[model samples]
Target: MARSTLLEVMGRHVQANHDTALQCWDGQNKEYIPVSYSLLSQRAFYFGERLVNTTKADQIQGQVIMIACHSPYATLVAFYGAISVGAIPMIFPMPLSLGSHEALTERIKHWGFAFGTPAMLVLEEGLNEKFHSEIPQDIEVIRLSDDPAASTETRSKSANDHQPKSDDIAFFQTTSSSTGDHKAVSISHSNIISNITGIRLAVDMADDERMASWLPLFHDMGLVGAVLFSFCNNYSLFITTPTQFVKRPSLWLKTMHEQQCTIATAPNFGFDYCSRLISEKDRDAMDLSHVKHLFIGAEPIRVSTIQSFLNKFSSCGIDAQVIRPAYGLAESTIITSISSHKKPSDFICVEADSIAIGESIRIVDTLAFSDADLSRYDPSKSVAVCTAGKAIDDMRIDIVDEDGNKIDAPGITGEIAIQGGSVAMGYVWGGEQLVEEFPDQYVRTGDIGVIHNDELYILERIKNIVIRNGENYLVSALEEQLAELLGISHEHIAVFESDIHDPSSDIVVLVERHAPIDEDQINQLLVAMPKEAFPINQILLSRAREIPRTTSGKKRHFYCRKLYQSGDMKFQQAIEVSPQRIMQAQALVNES
Candidate 1:
């Protein structure tokens, strides 16, 4: 059993399944349109060959190519085309609002200028006319619509015809949650192939297994794990937009059941959404008996959320053992550790007070631990669900103290560091000096976690934690506890420190309060909050609608932090307007 390059891996699949139906869409004509693998493969092959042959004309081999497209074919072409030509391909998440558009353009400028002009900008049909207007003078431009039958000749030969070393740089993807100037993580062919192989083995994916995924192609989970993994394994897959899942989560599951999806993975929040959206009527009409590997990842894994999902779906014949809690990041190419299929996994829950106080893990009985403290927690006693699970294949994980000494204990918590064949090359800015962070082989995840009997548990991002008055506060933990106490509904929340510009510093909690409450009620609640859990000096509440969130529904803390610092802050003040006040306001309106 010999492993092949990503390009060759996908090529073999495309060649074998040339006439197999691949893409399906409900068109405006109210009918299903299916595209075969041969169509998609040939389309990308033309563009891929053109990229290489044209690059030789300019003597550029590794210049970056950014693709902005919404069509399924365009996305496939953009990704495989870059891989075929040995150029660094990057994808930009579609900007929603005008605010996001401004932010994305600024990011492109920053990266483009930093990289000394891109090789070629690839735009899909409609965007070529609208967005291509501002292209930098030095960079070349190519449209996906330039030639529909472009790769007919190029599809004849395999990628083996053009030898690309395993170490050749394939592409770069920036952290989607990034703000201001974007930060990119570079991944090579070997990096992706290694991770994909490890992931395939971990999931026990057979050639006949099917995967259903709605995570965005720009996100690592969907791009490398779900999409690329399917291609590498020669498995069929069903993919749709994240917005489609958000609009109708039940549809995602319904389609999966209809397709008899055996393996599927999504962020934990997607499970939560499906749990909330699948009403009694919907549940009664649906059957999800075929879902085997229902993976939960990309965000904090809540035991309660998993339990809720299992409880709700168990009646629909969905097995409780199918709910697998996994952890991963882009630097590792979308898979770090996944739960074992040997048995149903258990979660780790500790006393909240101990964790808040930043104390070492002290395991009491589970029930006793829950009753002892409500705020702070010790990581060691946390439910096993919190563990990222054991390392796979050549991957090695270490929990190191601040002094770089490894802690060899189950209860010991420190920075999570990983070194493996699957680890990425590093971040790319410009020139060859781009990736220095992973100069050796290790990728410092910048995540805080603990190791318990060989299981890695992620506590939170070190950068997201706030330190004030000699106490470390996990803002997310505080938000979670508050949500439990207040009965708030949103899974996404962000807590950021706000400065008063006073000589005496004060910590302000900018919270997106889910429930409506008066300032007095909020203040009272804050005063009564568990001090040992997360100490707070002040409370600033906004409605849940006011919080800035990613398309994936993850809170954008950097945006919220900026909103607090800016004078544009608006608070949802609790006040009931009386009829008299309304009449007065009406009179004022009449006068105006």
Candidate 2:
């Protein structure tokens, strides 16, 4: 088998599609900047060669290079440039808001140790100083805008450069740790290509398809799936910053419409964000029916989100089926399973224990569930519905018991284990690849799930489950429920087990409210929740601007738990609260 290099695979396609090989949203111009394939590769080679020589006067092969850029263009240029020099580049997303320079420095310091001072950090403008003196002086810091490669000066290719192989590590993907740490998993070139191939096979990626995404370059879905996949497959990719999308979601719709984008992707919260925040007036002039593969992943799929987005955008000519529900992990390059062929998503509504049908959470109830009758399982209960679709190609998945034994039957809950070419090279630890033998084995996904007739359904991360009355419920599910009840978006609500052992109530639900805490709303929640769902001990009202989120935008509940315990969260509890938690909640509110 011939070795497949990143440049080798993408360079071939871009040779002809030079005109619109890459299209990035030019916010200043209120338009997109289309860079030709020839220009893109030209910059990659010129700067790549320069990077190889400037960083070190030796073989660049296998050297871990880091690229931190705010500009999507800068990140792309530096990434391919580093890769072109045969040095694996790990891309990190510039933090959205750093509040202070000290916070930024701390973040960089963490990353420096995470990868053990990569040979060089191709940092963005104004960010070079954050890493200065904090890390070893030997680790060179190259400002992206400074033109480390000096684009104008043609640099000669060195023999040490361009030695990429199939099995070589391509880049590192960041995975969030529970302890507020960030871990980067090594992804190989083969893993990326194989995963993209699986995406192509699973979704029937058409040659005529054009891609659009606002997901940050740091995440795999944005980097590999949208950005690099389109490049390698010879299609135009439309890129924008996540901040721009949040500020004006209408731009995303407009960009998609203008480019006639056939494929697009976002996390569940993103769709929910646009669905709620994007007013009907904002979408009056848009058309979205052209989209074929509107992928939703990077977070647990919510039935309400899919329905709400589809419902809200249906007026704009979007087919409800175009909104897909998909599942994946950073361990596997990007997407492993995505619904395709205009199929309506499959939603399984699991009966919520001690929940009655008349309850509030029952609004999401769908009839397709097998446990429809009260006899099969208690039907008089508020149920949580999750969209679980079929698996993609080139991937093998299994539901395993606690002991690592595979579950023989479908619908049995167990840990989700995945075996595929998409599986990353291994976890990077102490400047070395920890599991070199990882390729031959299944990456134990720490996610609890059930596979029914080959369809994968994620329940929750093993750590995020809250058990009450001997019945388990996911914190995400509670978040989803509280979002509906509170008339707020899902991402703003966080649920976690503050005290796991308490018999009466241990779970704490935190709501991100911009204004002062509403005592009436808090009282309403105390009255409505204890009967419909799990009993929440206390509701902590917080003003945390950036909900601690993973690169892919999944909420970090464990971190939030710590913030609550340490009293660091800008939380103002309602003056009046639950009887069991009134003393504590009121006391915290009194301090404010």
Candidate 3:
């Protein structure tokens, strides 16, 4: 096998399809915006040349630079340009509110000072007029345009700079984590290329495939998987913001149906939301026959949720075989395991008790699942409706037990450890020290899983397990029971530990319910919930429409927990009126 650079691989596709439409989007004016492969390549080449000439990126091969832009075209160009010059691109998140703007700017200034250089800051064209004064004048800002011939006469300084080796760092992706958690995952060009190849093989994607996505570019799946993979593979892409999809889930299907998109991907919540929104009348009018791989990922896969969606949309041309469950993280570039097409299987459920307490997985007959002791035997299958698939071509995955020993059995559940060409070289900060954190060369994905009959099944996040009294409570287990009992939307339910005065531990459920519930309804819910499964001390209900979520609809649990702890969420309290009030008023009038 030839080991080619990312640019080398992508250039081949660009050369083959120079005039083909590669990326298309709707602009602010609702007009279709199109960019071709020839244009995209030229933009990347010139921008990279300009950076090498002015920024001396060859000398600072391991340094970090931030790119800030709203336009999809500019972001893509700047991303490829930074990688082309052997500098790591750090994508700064857009400030959510005006209040956060100054603090985020201060953070950027501190980071720039620490890096000891005015990092290259790319801005959207119109943003110059809006916040140009706020940006430091010392930092270089470049504007990427749709024209392939764009250039500045004063740009030539040192095109003679030496090129970088394949081992140099390419980018640092920032993920949401605790301060103690190392959130940034460093990736090299080789790692990214391997990931692209791995994903291409895992999904069995074709050259003519098209992918529609609404995930934010800063996120791993959107940046590496959706955009870069699409560009590298000569696939057409239709992308928009998460807010746009949330406002109208129908639009995702409508756009896909119109474009005949074959490879569509999203987190588990996205599918749940789409299933809820697509009205029977509207679904009847739409066409979804072209969708081949509707991927559910970025979170644990729930069997019931997927089955409900298939049952709801089976009449609307949605082939149940298209549902694919995958597992991956930023540390592994993007995709580690994806569902396969040839064998094809539906979502499977399993016992949650065995997962958390028994430390094993036993595939009980799916038919006998409902009648089994609901506490000991999971009503749903332990395995999800999908499989995480075999490791990609050059990658390797191992299920290991404690004491760092690899497990050989198919039913034993353990930590999922991955290694191979696509596994990131190491993280950005702490260098060798961070490399030491991982075992040998494998990145221990903080996820639990099992290998069954050569396929992998993910259980739950290792960090999310709650230690209550002497027993351990897996949050996902509690969440699953709550979803089935309360009829709460699976996408909106999150269970976390709360600090209450009770000696017995407390678990809080932040549910996204549309209608306000009275105390009686809540009490009934508590009564119906399995007592041994999840002992609820307090339950909080909030509407999903008002809840803050990522562009992918994953809940911001950290922030929501903070708000709840501070007594910020509003809950309705019923007040009683008595007839004795009228007698008291009459007595007071007589005395007057």
**For this target, which candidate reaches the highest lDDT against the unseen true structure?**
2
RMSD per model, one decimal: 11.0, 10.8, 12.1
Query: In candidate 3, what residue range of length 10 has the lowest lDDT sum?
Result: 153-162
TM-score of each: 0.73, 0.74, 0.70
Q: Give the per-residue lDDT digits (tens) of candidate 3, residues 351-386.
A: 544664126785653322122222443333333334
Where model 2 places Cα greater than 4 Å from the true spot, the runs are 1-3, 56-58, 97-104, 113-118, 126-136, 146-151, 154-159, 177-179, 354-380, 432-439, 463-592
Q: Against the unseen true structure, what C-alpha lDDT does each candidate score?
A: 0.62, 0.66, 0.62
Off by over 4 Å in 3: 49-60, 97-110, 114-118, 127-164, 177-182, 366-386, 430-440, 464-592
What is residue 245's positional error in candidate 1, in angstroms? 1.6
